[model samples]
Target: MKKMLVFSMLILVLILGACSKKEDASNHGSVNDGEAPSEFGSIDHGVDENKVGFNLTGGTIEEAANVPAEEKDLIIRSFDTYIHAFNNQDLDEYMSTLSEKPKSFNLDEEREYIESVFDEYELSREAKDITIVKFDEETGESQVFANLVTKMKQKSTGLETKRDGRQVTVFSKEGGDWKVNSVYYMEDQK
Candidate 1:
């Protein structure tokens, strides 16, 4: 009787594991029926998953548009500088655009990763539809959204890969200068 019970338990556990795996597989490509969740909540923007870029929907765009023109321009300029620095492989220039105290990752880790990427690959990036998704003058914090396409070629093999995604870069004023605090990216489903 003891042996029979143990075998039955093993079979039940295996069945449950298989069911879980199947469920995960079914949800691999999209989340919440084509809407991706953000820090704010699910964004059901009806963005075509197969498309190469992202689009902002609902009140997010309106909120960004209400920010003062000067503040919005400053944030866009800061983001442009960051992209230019990365494409040029200028480590110092790129680092200058980021906050000394970052919220997403350690500064040292970022530096090391950027150094490695520069050494291993030649990269080019294009940013389009840049917008300020949110801004708070009181806190000196903002979120800049962009649709980005990056192409990277390996130095040794000459193999190239292209990535397209939507990115939200969080910025905060450090000593009166807007610096990048964190970045979140969601790759196109395709």
Candidate 2:
């Protein structure tokens, strides 16, 4: 009876230790630690699962690789237009790249709020390291995720301040042209 009790406790200890360690997602068929299953790349650290059900319009990964060079260039150009328009504050140009009747959220209020208080904030902005995270060839669509870092002047003594943010945009092919389908932006607190 004493031996059995000690063995049971040992097993429990081993099990607890295993549960406490971080599980490597790749070991269980997940692609990469940073590459979540969700289209938004949302990571649920607690549940070890990501949100799902984002059927973006794009060619499959295989198809995107086989895309003609000219078509690929067109897609890249459209993406460039989007980045430039945002930096230039060319709202019309930015909107033009988007799909007709596109669904836009989290912009109106945010923009109004920023515009209203921008004067109070010091602004030194730089957008760097824009990269194509993923593309689909079958649907001729792609997702562009970029990181933006900015420096906001400190209020009191005019010292420089810093801020960072991430944005994800979905672009789709329409009538042989690339257009933005949607956007998600997030800013980190400085």
**lDDT of each residue in 110-169, candidate 2, tens digit only:** 344444335354554455555455567786667655566756664667877565765556
Candidate 1 lDDT over residue span 1-190, tens digit each: 9999999999999999986653433232234334333321112233432221224332334336567888887888899999999999999999999988886556776777688889988999899878786777897888888878989899999999888777777799888689988776666778
Total clashing pairs for each candidate: 0, 7
TM-score of 2: 0.47
Inter-residue clash pairs, candidate 1 = none
* lDDT values, one for every candidate: 0.72, 0.54
